[model samples]
Target: MRKVIFYILISWWLVACNSSVISPEMVDECPPIYPDYVGVTIPATIAPMNFSCLDGEYERVDVTVTGGKSGEVHVNDKIVLFPQDEWQSLLKENQGDSLMFTVCIKKEGKWKQYRPFPMYVSSYPIDYGVVYRKIAPGFEVYSKMGIYERDLSTFEERPLLENTMVPGMCLNCHAFNKTNPDHMSIHIRGQHGATLMQIEGECELLDTKADSILSACVYPYWHPSGKYIAYSVNNTRQSFHAVKDERVEVLDLASDVVVYHPETHELLLSPLLQKKEVFETFPVFSSDGRKLYFCSAEAKPIPEAYKEIRYNLCSIDFNPEHGTFGDRVDTLIHAAAMKKSISFPRPSYDGKYIMYTLSDYGNFSIWHKEADLWLLNLQDGTKRPIEEVNSEDTESFHNWSSNSRWFVFSSRRGDGLYTRLYLACIDEDGRVSKPFLLPQENPWEYYDRSIYSYNVPEFTNMPVELERRKVERGIVSDKRIQVKVRQ
Candidate 1:
């Protein structure tokens, strides 16, 4: 009957996709995307023009300059000065002379001049991701701290989230992060103690009073609903039983405004193991925001270390209404059939399919061997290899487009240590097309030094805040809010 027809239809679609071939012309057709290059310049000193330089040159001399993202160096767009003239007004007042400026050509937005730093350099801006490190020795700029916006065409850095927040050393692991909608979070470590911050203009301290329940919060994930924010808190300061345990907590963003609102709380599940006893971490929400999926290792100290260092994907159904989660569980994948370790599970926007990377840690270099892409069906839980999309080369860090019809991921399959971003189309039948590399006109790509580790890719629809504002304004027509949280 109808059930048989559906099965037959699904089978035909799967066969057609497996036998399909992607062409090179498709790569040329992709629209160009440029990296937001932030150019800066700093003098050895910042005193008045007379004494600002070690040479003690010029009297009240006017050091004129201009800059900005568009390359237009107008009065307040992007410029810096030593004597504090009209350009100074455009800068974040009180900004030191070491301030960076941008002078955009009225025509192409090509930077006219970018003062070189005394000690360090910049990372290339590729589609997947970009990591910048400050080279100055006593320089306070954290390696992981930098202004990030969905579209930098009109971005302005806020002190709370950008400047006065992240500690220099902690930036790498607690790098700048953006959650669902307009919600942003950062792990701000200061002289008093470390606090898990969640805010847009400023870093709101989640554990300001130095609470003992958690030591430090990092690696935050925003629930799709934007009402909840979750992060892993360190418990190294506390005494442990035979079983070492860390806690993951969620905050009520709407009501958790105080230093630590009473409404805020942690999940009772403390690194629970599956029937086989494995440790789990790095949880992500499904498209429907019902299930929490993450990677798990064996339960032994380092416990559950995939003898091969391979991690399995697992999930826990969470019912937000009931405010509780079900038991720890594994997906239906034949765990033993995987070749290399499976890492970084990313569910598509439609919730119909999931994509992940497959590779061996020994061949950690993205250039050493290929990290193939695999797809799984959420309906019946059927899994298969994406043959045309993978190579003996490295391919990881996949992200979905706003429509779910397109996806962007990173791969060094044929390109050496050079991992670039690719855009692929997914059909209605759940078939993934060949990946097309991002075609920015420039040949200068952001090259990552960590051979084994490539940049992690994340995608979003529009600005995070705008989306949240729409929900608050009731402009969205979807009645999905009525959908119950899965338990």
Candidate 2:
């Protein structure tokens, strides 16, 4: 009803504008476009995959999209800008179908039609949007950065919190419990260093460092029940690479994993996870909350042996009922045996697959050019690289949608400096499709001169309910509840 009326308004507006349709000379080659939406499978609820011509001197673009169900949408402009309501209607009508795009452009007073392309629509739907950090690529300086959320259905992005809001503070390490915006945990560093969390609609500021803990919490993941959050306390250090195009090698001196319960303000410590001879980080809970997955490496001398640091995928039984851990640990994927490192191990909500980033040696994969996404089949214990989505550049920091049908990853594939977000679909039978870039009203306008890099992308079922006043109040109050170490 509302969509139909809005779509009608769009059609009437397009007709009223009286834009002249061009008859283009047919060309055999497809038009090279930015973001490359051609032949990629995307969720029906995604934003319009608008793109701009990359090669020619074009002043206007005209695209006609025809669905297999006979739904058609045409628009003419300098770039492809599909009507929001009409795009939604078209997608809803063409789920599990293909859309043929006939693109034409006017260049030098003549119109040319390129070879048509097909964009497949996946039957599965994505989350409401994604939440991620946008930060400048300054390795040594305190640059402006913020955590923002975007609506997948439209071109809208809003900041959950920014460093500017709390002056001189660095914001990072944010996590939500299984896409639930209500259960969120974000960290702030500076004079009022603390972790701001909202669990079950109750907000609290916590100073997670206890007397026994080595350092502050980093790389957090929420338990399924929303009662516990696993965090890695690390003594982190970094050094610059002398070679060109090399990034700051962020290395861990010492790290340990601990689980914190909000109700009792207790940090559960396990000697198996925090052994002095071992480095553990990036802990996440299984979908059923019965197991804890993390990355572990044998501790070596810092800086000199950093290249020898290889983390393997491991897990331990977790008793959510008693807030306890098992006596033994199991090595799931021995990445070190193959001279590879695993970082950011994320389990699917459906419990069928675990996606992780694999690099050569070090755990900091974002800077490792060989970093690629791999899928671990938990049911059969088979793991393989997601070949269809992997490129010649870095692909790290990935998360699955709540439905486990789609995944979002940050890649340094474009220009090899700034990380851009790309989404790919995986059907129930585990067929991964070619990844597509995050859409924008004018992608070229933004990506052409953007200086910020996308980081830590994760899907969310709803827009985060972070009240600016509440976060600001937490920053100003400088009060945090101290968590105690569990005996």
Candidate 1 yields a Cα-based lDDT of 0.40
Q: lDDT by residue for model 2 over 139-224, one digit each (tens)?
A: 66669999999999899999988888877788899899999988999988888789998976789998888889888888999999
After superposition, the stretches of candidate 2 with alpha carbons farther than 4 Å from their true spots are: 1-23
lDDT digits (tens) for residues 331-417 of candidate 1 = 645343454556556677678887876665311223325467788889988887787567666676666655566666677653444
C-alpha RMSD of each candidate structure in angstroms: 22.1, 5.0
Clashing pairs in 2: none
| Model 1, C-alpha of 27: deviation from truth (Å) | 20
Each candidate: what lDDT?
0.40, 0.91
